[model samples]
Structure formats: structure tokens, C-alpha cells
Target chain A: MTVTATAGQPAWTHSLFRSGWLDGSALNFFLEELNPAWSLVRPAVRIRQIIEETHDTRSFVFKPAWGFGRAIAGQHVGIGVDINGRRHERRYSISSAPARGLVTITVKREPNGKVSNHLHDRIKVGDRVFVSPPQGDFVLPSPAPQKLLLIAAGSGITPLMAQLRSLLSGRYSGSIVLLNYVRSQQDRIFGAALDELAERHPQLSVHWCLEKENAERFSASQLQQRVPDYAERFALLCGPAGFMQVVRQHWHEQTLDERLRFEYFGTPQPFKPDDKPAGVAAHIALARSGRSIVAEANQSALAALEAAGETPSYGCRMGICQSCRCRKVSGPVRNLLTGAVSHEPNEEIQLCISAAEDDLVLDY
Target chain B: MKKPHPSRALSPQEQDALAAELDALRDSVVADLGERDARYIRRIVRISRYSAVFGRIALMFGFVPLLWPLAVLALGVSKILENMEIGHNVMHGQYDWMNDPRLNSQTYEWDNVGTSDNWRKTHNFKHHTYTNILGLDDDLGYDITRITGAQRWNPGYLLQPAYNVVFALLFQWGVALQDMKLGRYVLGRRPLTEMFAKLRPIVRKSGFQLFKDYLFFPLLAGPNLLAVPIGNLIANGMRNVWTYSIIHCGHFPAGVRIYTRAECKNESRGHWYARQMNGSANIEGSRLLYILSGHLSHQIEHHLFPDIPAHRYPEMAPKVREICERYGQHYATGPFIRQFGSVIGKFFLYAVPNLQRRPRTA
Candidate 1:
């Protein structure tokens, strides 16, 4: 048997070379050369539409420059934008379902948050912003639970809304109870949409805990009265620290820890401050650069290094990622995540969360 | 007070303040790392690959006589882009934050015959750390051509003009040989055994490059093998000349300073910054030329921040120039042709050093 050129190789090889490697080489290069922001590695997404969700929160819909892979509901992606001349990145949950070709991220303007305020005030429909591929562990399982209870407060509704949208779209047999805690009727995010979905689907139920209107908080007793079968459901709790604390205590008291799930929206606050002197300026010697600068006790080594114009790699400034690991040559450094102080001579420390306790040397 | 070196116009205290400010500027840029730098490199890599592929395809069809030179030029430009913008910057750990194994500084190998390991040791550490310091920086004259008045004149330098041309033609091989310290081996400074051990990687890398360019790609053309290899040879030569010119223009410009070993000893950060500014020169060009030069057009900024991404150098140049002005130091920068002309002029000037003058100290 003789093999011709087409017959010699497998069909998959031709398709692979035609689409995967050789496929968009010229077009991708052209797009990248025109504007680097549109490169496939960090695709620029143009805001297609904007929805005002509440007083301070807004949902921005974006059309990615390249073909974006569908993200699992509840997953977050880091959005990057150049505010002034500097780039800032902040992770936000994808509030839109995969079936919706456009991606959506709901933003709640924090009082002093740089990226949040920038996105809310400066970003507009038709403007482009760079986005990373969706990432995060807080996602619904492939075979989702039959009895799902989603408890959210304020902007925490973003991810849960995604889950609700996804569940509603699918042939889900589960009953979902959304116990949303808001300041008042005006503060409820996706209120009209949630109401419409609840009216259409018998399995979906919506409950609002308006703190200002009721002048009462959602205590364990109140939650029990609202949803008696909450203990039987797989509960996903997402809210501020105080709200999470109350929910966590209730779960712990009932020994329902396994049924509870949660996601933190921001860097977890360091536990009660240790007796280490606060706001003391300590000398930081950069070994490679052969320079020394003072790092305040209250500020992270990364922050100090950055303020001094040193570029150290970092991602997720919450001490979870090891991108900012540097050799602590000497002196005391405190781990912000764990209130442990190390006076070791040479050890690697994460610059993002490690604060200087005294004079120190770092291999930068 | 008597003046030391003309470039050392600032007092120690002023130098220290300038260094602190520059360091702070670098930190601020680093702290703001985001999509821009990442996208810049990714796009460059894609364009480089596209250029290479396009050039190879055109070369393979070398039966058409007109396509030969164009293919060679394209391939040469592609190689230059890869070596300078992508390979050099990535190997300097500029994009080390990306954590991609292929783009990593520690492991990335350029398309050139010179191995990445040797370049890191010789260029990244030795050349960057020592800069233009005499007896330490081999790059001062590349250990062969005497481009500065600091080096002692020898009868061998009479043939330097001719040797400079030969070095330019085979620049990649010259760099590989320089990394091996071939002159040290010839003079018996290092033993033949150790020299050969170091030359192993260079030889292996050269062989791989030869096989790919001369044999493999040509053989793929079957009957058109001869034309393809010849085209590749011309392309390689083009790349050699381009790199040789750009590199020499950066360090061998007329007004650029050369330091003595004693002056650089126990050098403070501020002093080191001063040395880098004095020693390096920049090429004035358009964005296209800057990209082609791998932003080494801003050589002064590069020398100051060897590990920072080179794409940032253009933005940093003005700030650095301001700092130099503040310190009353010369910031050498000019058009490429003028810079290259100065390098060529200096190449001849130092051929036979006049005994009337002594080497100046910092």
C-alpha cells in the first residue's frame, strides 16, 4: 500500500498544525504589534455593556479580544488596567455564565481601594482592559449538590449570582435558597433578576435580610426560622468577616463544618497584633543592588521595596502566592500571615507579607 | 579642589542621593508590574517566530533568484530580534516573574552558537558587575581589539583594524570563543584541559547550529540544498554584523569612559551608578529601531538596571538623563550612525597608543 501526503499523516496532525501552531501566527502578530494589550497571553477586553446593580456596585460586560475559554461559575480572574502610568491588578469573580459569550465582573467601589474605584469611576463601555484567564478554586462541582443554600452579603452576591445563573441555565433538579443580607432594599444586587428567577422557577427561593429596614440582624435563630432545612443543604457562605464569623460559629455549633464552604474577597486581616513594635523604621539592605533603605515596621517589605523603586515579582499580595520570595540575609522579619518572628541568619521570606522588625538584608 | 575624572562631577554625598532616588524609581516601576511588560515580550516572541518561519519558507524556495537576498535579510533581522530583544532580556531575568521554563533566565538558550550558561557568567555577572573597569571587564576591548587608551599598546594591535573586520564577520563565534577565554589558553594563563572543558558547550552549540542551518534545513530542500545553505550563511553573516555594530556602538563610543580596577574597588551603589552612566552610550532611534536593538538603544539605562525588563529603558532614559544632569555628569547618546562612526574611529585611535599620555584614573 502506498501513502499519499494527506494519507501519510493522521487527520489530527493536519488540524493541529493548521489551527494550533500555524494558525493565527500572522494575525496574532499583527494584533500584538498594533497594541500589546490585545496579545493572547493577556487579552484586552472591550466593555460591551454596563449594568448599574446598586448605589456603589456596577456590572461591566466585556468582549475579549481573543477566543476566551469558558470559565467555571464562581471562578475569579485578575483584571489589569493602567491607571495613570502604573498598572494595577485586582481579582474579581465572573458574574456571567459561560454560555454568555461576553464576560462580566461586578465591582463594588471600596472606600480607599485603588483598582476598584478606578474600575467603577474611570472604566466605561467601549474602553479596553486586560484580563487573565479565569482562575480560582471557588467553583461549583460538575455534579452539583441537589440541596444548595447560598448565603451572601453586599458584594459577596457576585459569585453566588454566577452560580445561580449557571444552575438556572442547566437541567438542575436542585432546590436553591439564596439568603442575601443587604443594608436595605436599595443595596440589594441583582434584586429584580433574582425576583424574576424565583417567580419563574419553583425550585429557586430568594430571602432578603435588610438590616436597616428590619433593625434586626440575621442571627442563628432568625436564619433557622427563615430556612428550617438549611442544615440539610450544602451551604456556601460569602460575606464580610463579621458575617462569616457568625455563620461559621453557627455551623461549628451544629457540627456542620463539612457542609459549609466560603471564599474570601480580600486579604484576610492579620490576627490580633503581636507585641512587636509598630511603625518602627528598620534598615533594609538589598544585597544584589548593594543598597540600603529603611522599611517601616507597619509596611510589608514588598511595599517598602516597591516604594524604593525595586521590582520584585508578586501576585496575590495576600501571602498565598510565593512569587515575592526573597532571601532574608539577616535581622528579624515577621510573617504577617502567621505572627511568627524569625531572627534566622539566612532564610527565604515572602516580601509581600513579611514586615521588618529590625535592620535586615535581602537578596533582591 | 583638583578634578579627578570629568564624569565624576558629583561629590560622594550627591552621588549617594542620586543613587537612592534612582533605586526608588526602579522599585516603583517594579511594584507596578502588570500586563504591559508581559504582553510586550509575548508579542515580540510571536513576531520573531513568524519572521523566522516566513524567512525559512522563502529560503526553501530559493530557486527564484530574487527571493534569496530578501529571505536572508528577513532571517537575519529575525535572528537579531531573537538574540537582542527576547534572548538577552529574558536571560537577564527580566521576565523571570512569568515563571515559564522556556522564557526563564536560568535555562533559556538563544538561537546563537554561544551557550546561555557562559553568557550569563561572562555577560550578566562579570561584564555587568565589572562594566568598563580595566583588567576586569573583558568587554572593554573584548580581550583582543584595543578600543580605549587604558590598554597597553603591543605590536599585535597594528593589525587590529583587519582583526576588527574579521571579528565583526564571525561575531557570534568570537563571543563563544571569548567566553572560553581562548586568548588565556593561547597565552597559557589557563591550562588546555580546563579550556577544552569550557569549550565543550560552545563546540556542541556550534555543531547544533551548523546542523540546523547548513544541513537539516538545506537537506529538506532536496535538490535545492546548496542555495538554501548559502542563503543561511549570508543570513548568519548579516546577524553577526548587526549585533557587532550595535554592541560596539553601546560601549566603544568616543566619549565613553573606561574605569581602572582601583577606582571600582569597594564601589558604593551611587559610585557604581556613576560608573555605568559614564561607561555606556545610547543610540537615538525610532521605536522600530529601538525594538530591533532590543532597547539596548538606551544602553545607559540598561547598564544601570541590568535585571529590569529592557522594554522599560526608553521610558527610563529621560529620568536617568535628568539624574545625570543633576549630578553634572555626561549622558552619552547619539544617532546610531554617529555612535558607530565613533566606535570605528576609536578602533583606529587605540591601534598604536601614543606614549605621550598615560591612562586616566577615576
Candidate 2:
């Protein structure tokens, strides 16, 4: 049931992708400790049983031969798997609790996910994987036993289950109001385990619902009415981008709720849009001798001013990223990032990103 | 089978082309900074250190009754330039081993020299990150600049080159202003450190003294001190172009080009090596070149290994060049005259200050 639910990757992951993360700056720090590229750390876990959660989601259970360290419910670790010729890595949260060492990873296959699909079809028990230490700030707040809420639409329940298992094991005895919804009752993952947990803990309650369930099962409306205690609990919602949007719109009346926590799947949101401007166009040239390409534009006076020829030295094309920066040879440039303007602007403008509105020349 | 966005977005052919160009350029930049240029920088660090000592002695004797009082003043100018560069290099952690706390503050102490803001920003951030990002780069053309460089002669210059002489001869008028202007740039661009924070109060006072002495002293030079004024005029013109030509020579090579964000993404670190090599050319390592290049003649080495002491760079540069060649990269370098010519080409054809770039053909 949770198979299809867990397969969906949130859109926020795109934000976390950065170039310097693989940089040599860390080279100095880690060079003596490990090889420049790969490091062998202590083993994280030993694969045990694989559980099929839903149509698209499957949980690979692993027993920690070495001790599995504690991790925050929403935290993640970068897992690198050797596939074909490349070592592919991605971050994932452990679904099981620390005490069990039975690490359960609920994976949902995407259209062309490299590592995800590989894990789905090829991975099995006894396979050793390289993983980084636990990394992330998302977790349940301490000083527990307070009224808490856990909201998940699909596979977002992986981390929430960790929290629940933690509570069940007495690491944290917080009162949780776990509200998980799926397409149908049969699609609901951990249905048997959730019912058992509810039976064991007096304070732990589960409000499971299905948007489209069997005729005999309660629907979304009935489930909404069933969870009458939501108004009082802290909301930690995790799901797909579109799911969150719908959930947010559904509770627009309470949009200003202060106790809201969310974990999106992809990159962290930047303060501003990555594609804010139409972007400066310039006709930047490259020297005939070198391979450096220039940025050139026609409409922007600044870009036009830089567009002297067809060639210039450029490494990266995404402007505002700093690969195509060049000096002001003759005219003025209004820096797009910081609004200041100046000349004798030795390296005032990044040509690849900035466009020229005037006739310009570059040494390339 | 579906592929990730990366494999599909940049076609295999395009990636190959980008990769090839990147390797070629990186090789050029590394070789540009090689093993044979040790003596040139030795002179600058030595001259700066010795001149500073000379300036201190002259300051002590400036009260002499008949000892040609101008001797102290003359030595001071030589002291400031050499001292500033020495201060510049040391802030990069050059003198840490000397063990003089004043010479090597626990916190890399260039700020106390009243020159660099924080060595990190200028040396580490701007020089290293973008090395020379055209827009965001603070290395070559920050809104703020030392009063004595070509950007001074280039577009939107606030001062003229003749001020270096005026700064030397009629220095009472020009020196303070120069110091003040240079200070602002450092303050704005410097990577603030503990030493900088500690010396902030004094730096603020020296900054104030700039105006009081330069602007107010003219009324006191008593009108007939025209020799100082004539000297000031010569210095101004000489300083601007001299500094301009020198600084521009560091990164403004005919082969050197800037990369955009998109361009950088396609590039791996190996590719960045290409950018630095083709992006900057090393001029001949000569006494004159040393004075002008600030030992930056080893452009590729400096870019590749920023933390190694600049003095050591001349010795270690060849190893770096070899690395580039082994990697199938370019190490762009040449004689001083060739470098100077490249600067001229860059200034006219490219430095329009406009960032409009042409479509990059892989």
C-alpha cells in the first residue's frame, strides 16, 4: 500500500544540488583521512528482509552489524551505490528506529531515477552500501509528551514511522496524532503495524484515511470528520509538492497556524527566483586563439556593449552563477545581482549572464 | 530507458566538446605560473620589509635641524608602497612563521597594516571563487579600488594617474586622500578578521586624519611650494597607468575568458583548471615584473594553489604546470611584452563594462 506512496520524491531536492559540495576545499580536510574521492567509513547496516509496502513502494530492511547511530526523524544520509560504471548517491531517511538496527528504506520508483530504480529492481540482502553520517535539521521537538501531530499523504510517512517507532521503544514517549492518507485502504502502508502500535500505546492514535477506497471503507470526508483533534495539535506535514499544495489550500482558513512543520523533497528554496530576470542579452566574443566563449546580447545596452565578437572564454553558461564574468573594457554595466554600478570595472560584469545593449569588444 | 536530466540535457557530444575545451584552457593557466620565477617576488618582499625599516628610521629623524628634512619624506613614499605590498602578502599568512605577533597576528593581521580589509575576501573569496568574476568579482573592479590603478584611467575613473607623483612630492595633499580612498575599498571588500576587528578604532582615526591633513595642509604649504605640486602631478599620472597596466596584466590575457553559471555547471574542477589557465597569463618574472605583478606573474599557480605562500609559488609553479600537462590542459603564459599586449587587447576589445555575451558554441 505504501509502495506507490513512498516512490514520490518531493520537488525540494533540486535546491540542494550544488557544485562545491564535491569540491577540493574539503580535499585538504579529508585528504589525509581518505582518498580524495572516496572514503570508507564504518558500515551503517546489514540488509535483512525486504518489505513490499505498496504498488510502487518497497522497504528494504537492514540489520546493523555495527551500531546504527541515532538520527532525527526527518534527517537523511547520502547513500552511494555502485551502478554500471558510476557511484551514484542520494539521501534517504531511515524508517526504522535506532534500537532495532532494522533500517527500513521506503523507495518509490520515478520515471528515470537512476539509483531509485536500481534499488527497486536489483538491490538485495547482504549488499554493502556507502553512506554519509546523518545530516539534516528536521526532527521532532523534545520535552515531549506534548500534543503532537504527524501528517503524511504518501511515502512521506517513512520518517514519521521512525518517530512512531522511537516512541514505541520508549526513546520518546510523546503523544502523537498520526494522520496518514492514501488512495485506498489496500494502498495504506503499515496498516497492520499501525493498528498494533495503537493497541499498545494509550497515547498513540492513528487516523488512517483513503481518498479513494473500497466501497465498504470510509472515504476522505468521513476520515476528515474522524480526526476532530487536529485543531489542537502541532502539524508536521510531509508529502509531494502538489499534495502539500492541496492540503494547504484545504486548510486556508487556518493558514496562519503557527505550529506547522514541513519537509519538501528536493532543493531548499532560495530567497529569490533562480530565473527572476528575462536576463541580460549580450554579444560577447572569444579570442580566435583561445577556446573561451563570450556572452553577447543585443537589447541590453550593457550586454550589447560587451558583444564585440562571436568568441569569449566561458566555462558555465548559467548567468548569475559567476562562470562568465569579465571586466568592463570601455562602457558601464549595471550589476544585476547587487544593484551598484561602476566602471574601471576590472571584473564588474559576468558576461555570460549579463547581456549588452551596446556595441562592445572583449579580449576573450 | 529514461535517463536523468543531466545526461539528456547536455548531449554526449556537447559534453565531450565542453570537456575538451576545459582541459585545454586549464593546462594553459597552470603552465603560466611555473618554477623559474622565484627571484622576482623575493625582491618585493625584501624591498617592502627593508623600506619599511628605512621609513621608520627616517620618521625618527624627521625632526633633524639641517639634515635635508626631505629625506624622511622621500623614504616614506618608498616605504608605503613596499610596506603595503609586504603587508598585502603577509596578510595572506606569509609571515606566520616569523613568530612576531605584530608581524604575524594570531588572526592573519593585514588589517592592522591599514591596507587589506580581511585577507580572505580579496585573496580567498574574490581571487579564488570567481578568481575574476566579471560582475560579482571584487578582485579586479570592485566599486571601490585603490586610488592608483588603471580603472583610474579606464571608464568611470574618479582619479587621474598623475596623482602618484603628486602623492609623492605634494604628498601632504595627495597622500592622505590616497590612503583614504584605498581604505574604503579594503573596508568594503576585506574578509573581516579578529585583527581587523581589533584595529577598527585606529583605522577609523587614520581614515579621518586623511581628510584633515590632505585638504587642510594645502593652505599651509604656503603657495610657493610648487616643487611639491609639480611632483604631485607627475606621480598622479605615473601611478594610475603604472598600477593599471600591472593589475590588468594579471587576469586580462587575450586567451583568458570569463565563464557564466551555466558554463561552470558543465565544467568539473578539471574544467575550472582550464578556465584559470586560459583566463590568465603569466608575464615574465623580472625585477620590474616582480614590482608590477606583485608576484602575481604566477597567475596559474596562484589560482590553483591559493594558500601556499606567494613567495613559495615561484618555486612550486612548475610542478603545477606538469600536473596540467598530465591532465591534458593548457598553461597560458608568455613574456612581459606579450602579456602587456594581451592587456591592451583586453582593455579595448572587451572592457566596455558591458556583460552581454555571445552564444557559446561548443
* Steric clashes per prediction: 6, 129
Docking class of 1: incorrect
Off by over 4 Å in 2: A1-50, A61-69, A82-88, A99-103, A171-175, A214-224, A250-252, A267-364, B1-362
Clashes of 1: 6
Which candidate ranks first by TM-score, i.e. highest? 1
Write candidate 2's Cα lDDT for B103-145 as tens digits: 2311222212233333333444456666554444555433433
Q: What share of the true interface contacts does each candidate keep?
A: 0.00, 0.00
lDDT of 1 by residue, B295-321 (tens): 999999998887678999998888889
Q: For model 1, how does the per-residue alpha-carbon lDDT over A72-150 read when each residue is reduced to its tens digit?
A: 8887766766654444456788888766467888888888776788888888888888776666667776699999999
Clashes of 2: 129
Report residue A362 deviation for candidate 2 (angstroms).
28
- lDDT for each candidate structure: 0.78, 0.49
State the fnat of model 2: 0.00
Give residue B303's lDDT in candidate 2 (0 to 100): 64
Task: Encode model 2's per-residue lDDT on A110-151: one tens digit a residue.
Answer: 556666788788888766565445556557667553778888
